[model samples]
Target: MQKTNNLGSIKRLQREYAAFLKSPPPDMTIYLIESSVYECHFSFKGPSETDFAEGIYHGKFIFPYDYPKNPPEVYFFTPNGRFAINTKICLSITSFHPETWTPVWSISSMLEAIRAFMLTPAAGAVGGLESHSDVKKEFAKKSQYYTCPVCGANHQELKKIFLLENDKKNLTENIEHQLKINTSSTEVTSKLSNYDKTEYKLENVEKDHKIIIEKENNNNQQQDIIKEENDIITQNEINNECKEELLTKIENDEINKETKEKEEEINQEDDVLTILKKRQEAEKEKIKHFLENKEEIKEETERNEKYTVINETINIIFYLSIFLIILMVLNLLKIKIIMYFLN
Candidate 1:
């Protein structure tokens, strides 16, 4: 079911597009590019004797992917005009086209809407009308005479086409209405001039305001980007500092470990020295004891030798005793002589 509807939509678009190509509207020059079927460029002259009369303007009309189902977007190419670029123009027919656009209304009807909409002001619209009466009038003069490059025809062809295609009663009435006109031409012109001046001033002020807003937005975006970049740089610097500190700490730890090991080794050497000093003191005590025992042995051996000699001499000693006593008495007498010798 969906496929069938899709095919139907395709057929309708193709049919509408074919009809438009077969007979394009008069006065407007349309150029269709082969690559994009929905996009077209057009050139048209402003309406005659009016403010936008003589200007040769270029514009673009872009059909959405949906084409005739939705209204095509229209935008002016030239900047030297009252209306802004790509500003949407409102028309009763165009607005209602989505629901009420019949196959019966040809491309010519749409073109008429374009023309009429350009003449009217689109208040509060982006790229809306802003030209002075004098400016529009001057542009209108040139618009009427300019030739459409695509069609190789002038705008007079358009005016003739409009006169022929439009309601005959309105046209005939408009001519008679001109004859019966009561409003002074100068008064209307003066009033139009004032209106144009006011409109132009407001539109120009709006344009300036929009430009300032766009510029401020761009500056804010740039500042945000710069701030982000600065933050990233600051974070990177902090990370680098942390990494450096960690490396230094690691190196210091290694040095401390080496110092600790060396201190431990020195302590072990001091323990070994203390053990050697205790062994040396024990050896010296043993040597001193051996020397004292040898002295005692010599004294005992001398006493034994004196006992044997006394026994052998006992008999002889009896007779010698008396002699010894006399010798002792003589020695006692000689004591005074010994003492003198000693002194």
Candidate 2:
């Protein structure tokens, strides 16, 4: 049963991969590992006008054997300042939240969602970092030259290739369109020239047309060479800029390190003060409880004393009534005796 499930998962992934090739996601490229359909590599540019802008991020997705029923683990190998490098991030669409996973959700949609999520605050999220805007911006700039260990290509090279491929496609389409226009023009010219026929003149005209075509081709080739040279110059400039930035960054990091140590010391002092305040509050609470208990005890003792006094007063009154009754009985007995003697 397990084997069967694995096979099904592979099939599903293959189908998805085919569809992906047919209509790839915009501004991103996904490459499935040659050995396994379960693992995939993806690269994309960071969203523009955001903290992550101008960055090319490389990441991986590891789909589970029971995929579609479970979400894949998402990991970013790039240091984008939003997520930790090579760590599986916790997101609603990731393996951490299987309940939210749906069979309909494809890799493209997940990438889109992740790009959007990148703009959100970290807020102490797992596998997320709360970097300063300046630090993030610096990272974004550095990302262009960053090389992906898995892909074995730097961001700049990857982007250049992507652009080249698009340019080639556009160039092909333009050339085809131009050829059709030239073919129609050739037919029209032939029809017009036929009205003023001369075989020798026609041959000369054809030769002139071939020369023009050759010149155009040479011009195109020269333009291509110039573009390549410009690209090389630009790359050299970028490298120099990166070196300077690295030097400045190193100096800034040293300053930041010192500031961090001072901040940590201040935080430690604040922590101690907080601990002392908590202890004092606890002592106050204990004292308040003791005083409350003492007051209750005092009130209870007074109530007991009042009850004892009332009981004593009732006992004294009862004894006095008994004595009066005894005296009255004795007098009545004496009167009865005297009357008997007189009789």
Which number leads on TM-score?
A: 2
| Candidate 2 minimal-lDDT segment of 10 residues | 242-251
Model 2 misplaced stretches (Cα beyond 4 Å): 1-5, 162-343
Taking the candidates one at a time, how many backbone clashes does each contain? Answer: 11, 0
List lDDT for all candidates, in order. 0.59, 0.77
lDDT agreement of model 2 with the native: 0.77
Badly placed stretches (over 4 Å) of model 1 are 1-14, 86-106, 140-343
Give lDDT tens digits, candidate 2, residues 103-123: 899988889999998998888
> In model 2, what is the error at residue 117, expressed in angstroms?
0.8
TM-score on alpha carbons, each prediction: 0.35, 0.48
Please give the lDDT score for candidate 1: 0.59
